[model samples]
Target: MDAITTPQNRFVREKDVEALPPPVATGGPVAWMRENLFSGPINTIATLLALYVVVTVVPPLYTYFIGNAVWTGTDGNACRDEVVGYRVGACWAFVWDKINFFVYGSYPADLRWRPNLFFLVFGVGIVWLLWLDAPKRGLAAIYFFLFVPVASYALLYGFPAIGLRTVGTGLWGGILVTIVVSAVGIVISLPLGVALALGRRSKLPIVRLVCVIFIEFIRGVPLITILFMANTMLPLFMSEGVTVDRLVRPLVGVALFASAYMAEVIRGGLQAIPKGQYEGAQSLGLSYPKMMYFIVLPQALRIVIPGIVNTFIGLFKDTTLVSIVGIFDLIRTVESARVDPVWSAPSVNYSGYAFAAIFYFLCCWGMSWYSMSVERRLAASEKR
Candidate 1:
């Protein structure tokens, strides 16, 4: 007797789809500036202060580089006049005059090609390694472990295989010294750092204690003190009249200093690994060394690649400190150039420092960029 009619369903179609709110035009460049620069009292103050700084500093820098008058002359009096009375900017001519000695150092006028070739080979090898994603890793290991070092040593040491003449270490200076010290320090520190890190975490108390002591003692002291000790005490440690090569002393000091820092960096990576990794290796019946090499260390080392590169960059910069100990590194070469009778003005000294600064900046910046790229690659691989 009572039949109820059912309501028809409402079927939504494409035209019924709601549109997204109009793209927020509030957060683009102008909106960002409004939020960050003019949002509140504190933000306004900071923005104004930054603008004031730009107004005060940027123009003078621009004029110094582009508009300031520069006098270029070899005569000391003329150079002096360029800076005697008023505010003067950098004298780039000083750099132009002494650029040769800065690059080649006191290496004999005829034999600059040896160091230049060393740079070329090292640079090419590094670029090759960085650019090749699918390179034969085993071949790279062989090149890094066996071929590059031996070849570089022979070539730089003038072993007559490459038709290069023997150049004494004393002849090494400027960027050559910086490169040699950093390269040798990097080569030595990697293995030494791994050993030290392992020893610090060893089951043997004695070994752990020794490594701890070595790392702490080195880290506790300033690198300048270490360089001084290396320069003075090393000669005494050797037999009298043995005459340790001055270059060798600084190289040893740099390597030792770098290794200490590297050990701490590696230890951090090791600590970040879970204990399960170690226990898993043991459960698989792997020996201590085999377990570490096969499972633990590769992951740990990858974790620490950025840190390793940072330590390398630090050591590279610290090579400049050898100048204080009378080793003629790049900085010292620049200092020596400033003292040249032809370019002894204050402006010239400033220009020389600028040149050295640019050189250091280029190297350190490149290393930092490489470290960043490696970090990103590792992070992406982990995600996959």
Candidate 2:
């Protein structure tokens, strides 16, 4: 034993490793429910309450809108008990009959194709702006900013070049009026507001003072008063025998009112830019206007896009107020439709309002989606 030399192995490894079993509960619906809805006593109670609310509220809505909705009827009477087996069925027929009014208002029936065509082109342009990228977007923006309004005017009023009959402004109402007012307000307000914001931020005392006064004055006054003043008071100041169109007044008022609020929003963005950004631009030998146009404004606008869109959405909904000044916009058109004695079923009225809400929701939501997409794209570019 003493003479024996031993060689010993020093390394050892496990040959019988145990495989992992699945988790007690993976991240499936069950785990999500547990985490989100029933992780604690408070959460469990909230989830139960919410489920109860849904169970109680949803079925009646479904029954009313879908189960008993009258899809095919010529009049309210047709939507009543004799027709849909119950008078309570929603009178979708009334909405159907007045759909044209909702779209074109009192635009002459024969010449509606013009507005319809204009709508088609405008819609396509909007879709292009939303779905496609700029620089390669074939300038859909140019179409909207330059060609659309002029073309809309010509087509809507009657293009002598095209042999279309002129439709008087007096006859314009319904969604046509709503769209025009909102579009004009949005288009004019943005640039005007940007200018005002810049002026308010200008180093020149006189310019900044003027901007502050105008912005404050506009912001202080009620929009309806502005509309009234634009409609009545402005004419008194005009040269004798000069005429201002009634339709033009509300449009001006809405644009001016919107611009004040928009200026504040843009100003907030401008103020958010760090002082270093301004100094950096100045160090590069950029002039004041050049610094703004090439450097500052873009970043400021990017920062305040949500505010800008919020302002636009407000202006869009505010277009309904034009009804006070006698412009029959979308809501006004619906109001006019409701007065028809033949379609005055209670169900019809509720349906009409719901329809209007749906239209506004679709518009605002689409705009929001577009804004978010643009934000994501810009963020990606900046990261790159």
Candidate 3:
């Protein structure tokens, strides 16, 4: 009877539709948690312990930084004399009062807007690079690389003919000095480093010798020594009694030191390149300079992006050392700010330092993020 009924219904018999596959063994959050945080009984226990530690640690940090903080008022008394739960909380009031010191140092109060304008222009240049997607990118690059610096310097240093008052480098402190030194170091080091790397690999013996010695000498010595020597002895080389600008001396030292490190980094990348690449360029009748410039250097630079960025970060942080030579980079400026009797408080010092740390971290992280993104994009282009 069943067989007869089935045959009768054969033209249009309905059956359950196939169930969807079980999500193809997804690597979703639940699966990941299971694998990494709860892979075994021991791992689960360890994760719980870590969470406990985090809980224990985070509250105090929050209390120190935010929960007990005083953000208003003009002086240290706002933090100290106020009737509140936390006398020991962060005194961000001091930071706010001395914010200009941390930004422009002793830059003229009225002329502060000039540096502000320079910063705005610099920001625009960076936005052009990272976001604008402008059609005349080559011109934009030229403007950014060449004209921007001139304009910024003129703005900050003041163009007399334009009625801008001249602000000496001595007055340039805080983040302004730090940014200038680091930027100059990074910009000068890269091309100089590339040149040294090429010279080190040159067939000319004297050229190779000079490059090798320069790199080794610079790399072997400490940056502090180089900075000191630049500050003290650079004038000895200059004719008669021509004194170098205090800022210029540090810039020179930082550039030379960073370039030496950069040279080694680039040399390593040059060595990593496949011999076939060089041979292919030669086969195509490219000159030595043409081959290296058109093919070899680009690949080498890409390969050494991490090292280049690392050197840049180091140079940026090292600019703080300029304070030792009587230049007031951000750290020095913050230190000086904390010493002011009006704002003097334990929390004030910490707050100032914390602000500097956040600023530096933002700059370094932005640089790293941009470089990695560029690297991935370039790799994809090559693949296509």
* Best candidate (score: lDDT): 3
Query: Per-residue lDDT tens digits of candidate 1, residues 264-296?
Result: 999999999999999999999999999989999
**How many pairs collide in each candidate, listed in order?**
0, 0, 0
Q: lDDT of all predictions, in order shown?
A: 0.81, 0.86, 0.88
Model 2 per-residue lDDT tens digits across residues 247-292: 8889889999999999999999999999999999999999998999
Residue pairs with colliding backbones in model 1 are none
TM-score, model 1 to reference: 0.84
| Candidate 2 error regions (>4 Å) | 1-19, 23-50, 81-83, 130-138
lDDT of 3 at 143: 75
lDDT for model 1? 0.81
lDDT ranking from best to worst? 3, 2, 1
Q: Extract clashing residue pairs from model 3.
A: none
